[model samples]
Target: MSMTVARRPHRLLTMAPAVLALGALFVIPAAPAVQKGDDFLTPETTGVLNLEPGECFTDPEYSPAAGEDIVLYTTCDQHADNQSYGFVHADDGPYDRVALADFGWTSCKRGFVNYWPGAAGAELDYYPILPTAETWADGDRDIMCVVYDPRGELGGSMLPRAS
Candidate 1:
């Protein structure tokens, strides 16, 4: 009697597409279905002081007069109150608050578009907190840019995903 050995088929090629699609489906749900909240500002934490790219935060009652910004960090999963998109800085020397505001508006808007392409389709809005005259006098030159949905709160990062 002669016996033959059978080899198992390669599951990788067949399963690869399904695995990627399943991953995409799981990730897609996190982006749009975030719940909005009335409590906008998050509690102060050290995370705020060291904000990084793609970090989400909140400072609803933000006030430059209160000294350094106290941000509350939160997961971008579907409960994000606000998101920090980018920052702009003033060139060396003194700049008027008005000029600074103008620059902030322009710079933040550009940052917003680049960070979140959704803005182009009216899917998002942006705001820039420019340094106040008092703060500017004290050498505060950072302009923080934020991306938010005016219609309601979001639950995820506004940033586009890598293909």
Candidate 2:
């Protein structure tokens, strides 16, 4: 799939071409060896489709020349730029960028409300990391809904706390 990652502008509702590339200053190494009985081991770089709900990560950085995207997983308690809230699968159909984006936007919006019911009045915003034509052709149909605090880094997960 060429390792390209597409992202919409943070907090924007308009539909635009999904050709923007996220850039990072440094590259992280591959996944570390896991210890016995460990619950989870986050990889240094991963596609958006691999992120699970409530997992925190830095925004992915991509270089068009390199045709690669790098997403660094981080602990929710630490400072991070985004968090996976939910995922939506695109319906079976021909590859239409607009159609896919429309479906993703609508679905992810509903997911955002469901994931964080109290976010309507907050400064938090959500964006979707969608599949490109290359990725779609390779059977990638998942859209990841990610939430972030527009003001700065998120100190914790956006998932609602238990009562």
TM values, all candidates: 0.57, 0.63
Which candidate number maximizes lDDT?
Answer: 2
With a 3 Å backbone cut-off (N, CA, C), the pairs that clash in candidate 2 are 22-61, 22-62
Q: Candidate 1, residues 1-163: lDDT per residue as tens digits?
A: 9989896878898799999988887773434533322122221322454666567766444456665546556777756757778778878577575676688778888887777665643767776666655556777777767777765666577777888
Candidate 2 C-alpha lDDT tens digits along 46-102: 544456888988765775765776666788878787888887888867888777767
Q: By summed lDDT, which 10 consecutive residues of candidate 2 come out lowest? A: 34-43
Look at candidate 1 and tell me the lDDT of residue 99: 75
CA-lDDT, candidates in order: 0.65, 0.67
Assess candidate 1 and give its TM-score to the true structure: 0.57
Error of 1 at 7 (Å): 79
Question: Which whole-number lDDT from 0 to 100 does residue 71 have in model 2?
Answer: 67
